[model samples]
Target: MKKKLSLTSKIFIGILLGALFGIALKWLPSGTLKDSILLGGIIKIMGTGFINAIKMLVVPLVFVSLVCGASSMGDVKKLGRIGIKTMCFYLVTTAIAITLALGIGKLINPGLGLDMSSIVTTETVIAENKSLVDIILGIIPSNPIQAMASGEMLQIIAFALLVGVSISILGKKAEPVKILFESLNEVCMKMVGIIMLVAPYGVFALIANTFATVGFDAIWSLIKYMFAVLLALGIQGFIVYSGMVKSLSGLKLKPFLKKFANVAGVTFSTSSSSAALPLTIESMEELGVHNSVASFTLPLGATINMDGTAIMQGVACIFIAQIYGIDLGITQFLTIILTATLASVGTAGVPGVGMITLSMVLTSVGLPLEGIGLIMGVDRLLDMTRTTVNVMGDCACTLVVSKSEGELDLDMYYSKEENNIAKNA
Candidate 1:
């Protein structure tokens, strides 16, 4: 009898084959065969359908799972601590990512000889630079129905917390509601499992389509900028995340990376952490994090933790400044970090959203928005890599919280057999 392949192995195989298939398509003649029939028709359908399937689960999963996580927290103080720690870890990592990116960009001088004379500035409406007051007020959700209809995550998070806390406080009176949410959370997690059975094909289609269309030419044009962003991502993922996992959870780094690779593949192909959340939760559980921590931290991380995006913003800001010959003063550099860190909160979990938030960062540093035009061509590919890093940050945060809360199972984390048993059970 043949052994069943693990999901991680399947996902990696899918990514390898998909990349090769895309490259083959890129080599095809420049006419209808490659552009119209292959990329536009078949590839588009498969990729878009898969993303839609994942997206359909995001809001429901976040709401139901978060509600369950919150209500299950018997102690309000512990919940508060979890919230504070989670937010602090996410923000601190993002700041570190930006700082690292800036340092690398300066050393590399990615934009030293770049010419922006021909880059035209369009008067696009930039993302609103919300003040602290505005951001606080906005979280209240004047109309929660509208918030849900629009998929407003921060508002949804706020509303869910309210419901969960109320249920926790009410005790017996809220038992029915709490039980219903727990059932709903279980249903959503089961949905994630079912959806993931087809995940290999979905990841294949998404990646193949992306590579077939975008090709490598765009990347060559801005290689330095890409390298800068990727360097920061590499340092954060390998050095920072590995260190944290070992120190905080006291688990061997190898097993964590092995489990996280599956989640990384999903995030890389989809380029949307929100879409990747269901699988992230599953991957975290497979790595032995308790469901309460996985459910809460993963959702919260998807919404606000954006170390990857911040790294790109930081690198891009520096590159643009060098191109325009604008020397960033100390205060300007600090503002860039602060603005990018805060702006990530309002950023949506979707493809190419880094561009939107980049606009905010640039404006904060008095850089030209047209500089974005230079990076747009290669942004798609960078977005994929950075998003993988973003989700890694989420997983790392989940592990940290699980350790602190005594919710992590080291035996499960270290033992492959134990993980399989838990999955089978």
Candidate 2:
């Protein structure tokens, strides 16, 4: 019998072939064949459909999974502890990510000797700053229905968590509601499995379209800046994440990688952590993380855990400062870290959120907001990569919390054979 390709293997093939196909389009004569038929006709349809499909699942998946997670937590005190630990892990890692990015950016000096005189910049009007108190106050939804409609992740998270806790408090009185959420969670997971069947094609379409449309010139121009951001992401993913898994959970890194590849691929293709939450939760559960932990932590992590984005902001800040010949002091560096960290939480679920938060960080430290144009061309590719890391951070946190809570299934976690069985089943 011919062997079946693992989802990971299939996704890797998709990425490779997609890049090749895109580059091939660039080599073709610039005419209707390249511009109109391939890009405008086929690629747009497939890519848009795939993205819309993934996004369609986000709100429902987050709400159902989180509600199930919170309701399952019979011990409310432990729920509080889990919340604290998850937030701490996410924030600390984000701080570490930025610090690492700055060090890498400075050592690489991506902006030094780079010609920016030809690059055009437009003056941007920075939004009036809001107080920290106002930002915190805004998390509570004035209307839960509006929050859900708008996909306001932070507000949705807060609301879902509250509803879950209420059900738990009501106990037997809320049994019907609890059962309904549990059923809905299963339905959502089923939808995830169905949606993922289209992922390889979706991935192929998205990547090919991006490369074909954007071309390589934009990427090559900012190669150094891209390298620094990618390197920092690599360090965070392999070194930081690997060390956390080994020390915190005592799980072998090999199995984790084996499980995470498909999730990473989806995150890379979609460039949206919220869209990737369902797969992240699925992979975590298959890796023996209890549903409660996976559901609760992954949803929250998708909302606020942005280590990869933070790294990009850090590198971009340094790169822009060097280009403009601006010197940053210790106080300014501290401010960048603090601002980026807080901004990650505040800016959750916003489109083009990375650049928005980067703008905030820049404005905080007296950096020119117009400098954003320097990195804009390459942000799409970097966004895809950073989002993969963001989802990975969420899964890592899930594992860590499961370990502390004694929710990890050691047998399932260790048995590679079970992976095949689960998939086959």
Candidate 3:
């Protein structure tokens, strides 16, 4: 019998091939065929379609799965406990991530000896700085339907929790509603499986489009800054997350990473944690995280858990300060950590949102916003790397929470058998 490639292997191959294809397009002379037909036309359409397909599932999956998960939890107290734990884990990890980034940034000195005058200043749009009180208040949706339509994730999460709690409180009377949500949740998972069938091709197109437009040249100028961000992301993803899974959950790291490889690939290619939510939730369930846990934590994580963005802000802060020849004292360093950690909660899980939040971090510590423009050229590539880290953080937190709550299936989690969710679907 011939062996077949697994989805993980296929996605990896797609990434490699896509990089090569993109480089080939980059080297070719600019023309209608190279720039217009292939790069802008086919690649653009395919990549956008793939992203849209993935995004199509996020809102429905989050709302339905979360509702089902909440309703299934008979004890509202337990739900509150889980919520508190998840939030604490997210905030602490984010703080740790930025701290790590700051340490690494100082050691690497990514912006030292830079010729600031030669760098092109890209325009940056700073996000409005929302106070903590405002952010907390914004979570409660006055009109949930409007919140859902606008895709205000925190508001949607708030509304979903309320609806789910009502269903649980009603018990027998609300059985039909709970059953409907469960069915919808299953349908959403099936949709995830269906969409994943095209993920390899989608990964290819997305990666190709990125490299085709922003080639290797972009990294040459800010190579040290880029290296700093990449290094921090790598440590956070591999070492920090791995340690958390091992120490907290006692789960085997290899199996967890193997199972998550496909989702990581999708996250890397798309550079949006929100777009990868469906797969992230499905993968967690396959890894033996009960849906009640996966559904709740992953959606909430998608909305607020932003360790990766914090890492970037940390590194970028140090890099920008160095470029402008400013010395940050202990107070500034502490301020960066505090600001970035809280800012993660308000930050949306999308491409380039990090830069907007980065501005806020820079402002908090007195770094020039112009420094953002210097790194803008390479942010796209860095965004892809950091997004993978963000998703990994979500999974690690989910695993820890599930294990702590006794919601993890140990036998299933440690099972050596291949995960056939995508294949079987």
Off by over 4 Å in 3: 1-78, 115-221, 417-425
Which candidate achieves the best lDDT against the true structure? 3
Candidate 2 local lDDT, 68-139, one digit each (tens): 766765653557888788878988999999999999988998877643323213232323355666555755
Model 1 — TM-score against the truth? 0.59
The 0-to-1 C-alpha lDDT of every candidate, in the order given, reads: 0.73, 0.74, 0.75
In candidate 1, what residue range of length 10 has the lowest lDDT sum? Answer: 117-126
Candidate 2 worst ten-residue window by lDDT: 117-126
Residue 197 lDDT, candidate 3, scale 0-100: 70
lDDT of 1 by residue, 1-425 (tens): 99999654676576667778988987788888777787777876666565455556655766665577567555435578787888889889888888889899889888876544332232322234556676567668888888777655556667877887788888899999999998886777677677667666766765575456555532343698888888889999999877887787677777778888888888888788988888899888987899987888888788778899899989998887776666786666666777677556545553334554575567545576545545554566687898999999999989988889889888788789566669999
Model 3 clashing residue pairs (backbone): none
Q: How does each model score on TM-score? A: 0.59, 0.59, 0.59
lDDT of 2: 0.74
Candidate 1: where is the Cα deviation over 4 Å? 1-78, 117-221, 417-425
Report RMSD (Å) for each prediction in the order shown.
11.0, 10.9, 11.4
> In candidate 3, what are the lDDT values of residues 1-425, reduced to their tens digit?
99998655676677678778988988899999997899778876766666566545555766775587567656435589788889789988999999999999999988776534232223222235566676668768899999777655556656777888799888999999999988887777777667667767776776676567666532343688888889999999999989988999887887799988999899988888989999999998988899998988888788778888898889898887776567787767776787677566556543334555665567555566555544544566688888889999999999999999999998788775434544566
